[model samples]
Target: MYKHALAAAAAAAFIHLPSTAAEVVTQWNFNSLPADGATGTGTTAAAIGSGTASLVGGATASFASGDASGGSSDPASGDDSGWNLTTFAAQGTGSGTRGAQFAVSTAGFENLVISFDLRHSNTSARHELLQISLDGISFSDFALFDADAGGDRWYTGRTVDLSAVAGASDNASFAFRVVSAFAPTTGQYAATGVGSSYGTSGTWRMDMVTLSGTAIAPVPEPGAMALLLAGLGVIGTVVRRRA
Candidate 1:
């Protein structure tokens, strides 16, 4: 009976092994840290962790209000800013070519997830594609989003689950992009707003861009290992005496 109890306790310890919780690896809030009280002024540097944010395919970027057009998901009450992008490809040209890109190393992490808030202008492309790159050079489409709602509205919580992409975890070159794309089954881009035409001058405002993952637990230290071995030895001695 004592031997059985000891075996049961060992099994319980393995069964209850602690799990790592998901946490934000990197985040781009875009709002100034000191609250400058000006919506037109903000920083592109990540507000949490380290990463790089850049425009892609000749797009121009500026700071814009995250609170405009019904506001974004940002919790900031005042001086909230978002990364605004424009100079998209000409109508019916360069689909999935113009937008923003972000690079963040996922070293020592797994089960990656990406999320953000976006606001579409009236004449912006209705379809947007989320692309991922393991090598940070070539990208592949992972998901597509449609701003079906009328323009000047915030589309919060645009998320992509990359847990199944094994190469995305523990990778130093992981990167992603959100770009305008042609409407599904159509060769041309559709307007975000009804009764409007797609145009290159339209803007996309992004806020609360974040990457998250579960941290890989570190190996036990030498002292911890020694203690564990000593405990196991004690247990074996106890078991032998009981026998």
Candidate 2:
């Protein structure tokens, strides 16, 4: 009787095991602002979870008053406002000029995903690189975005999976480091105008950057499952003997 009772309890516990649900670890649409009617260039965006996102590199990052005339469609929210990272010739050239970082705490997620909307007035072939860091200092390249080469203003959506980079950590950080310059002197790229130097020269823009992941559920280890089965077998033998 005791053996059968123990086996039943074991099975019941296994059946009642809770399943883990995935969640949005962090998302930054760059829509929040200070009520004081003041916004800073490097201000951090309010995110969904405990993590925070902030502009790292660039002369200054701010919200666009309106969408670029020839650029990507304005965010569906129609705020006409989105995070803007502007590159100026006055600053160093290339990817070092613009960068943003999104850091999150409490990891152990599967299918880590990231998405962003971007627009640019600069000539095509300008490069945007995405990097991920486990330590928040050393970063490895995760993805890259190249301008359209057409030199027209446009916005486009991009998605990336970072499950490999995210690993099984409980805490991880992702950074978008954009290095840009005047579009190279290529066939159509040359007409875009002088690279970011004189007047409102150098500029790259982005918006609606989001990070998300699904929670990873723990599974019974092989040894544990085997032991449980063995216990059930013993329970069956004991019940048959009693019968």
Name the candidate that leads on TM-score: 1
Colliding residue pairs in candidate 1: none
Candidate 1: where are CA atoms >4 Å away? Answer: 1-19, 219-230, 235-243
lDDT of 1 by residue, 149-210 (tens): 88989999999999999799999999999999999888899999999998899999999999
lDDT tens digits by residue: candidate 2, 22-140 = 56776555544433222223234544565666555444566663245554443433344556655343322443334566666545666677777666554323555677766666666
Candidate number of the best lDDT: 1
- How does model 1 score by TM-score? 0.87
The number of residue pairs in model 2 that clash at the backbone is 14
The alpha-carbon lDDT assigned to residue 122 of candidate 1 equals 95
- Superposition TM-score, candidate 2 onto the true structure: 0.63
Candidate 2, poorest ten consecutive residues by summed lDDT: 184-193
What TM-score, computed on C-alpha atoms, does each candidate reach?
0.87, 0.63
Predictions in order: lDDT: 0.92, 0.54
Q: Candidate 2: misplaced stretches above 4 Å?
A: 1-13, 16-22, 33-43, 65-80, 89-97, 123-125, 149-152, 166-169, 173-201, 219-243
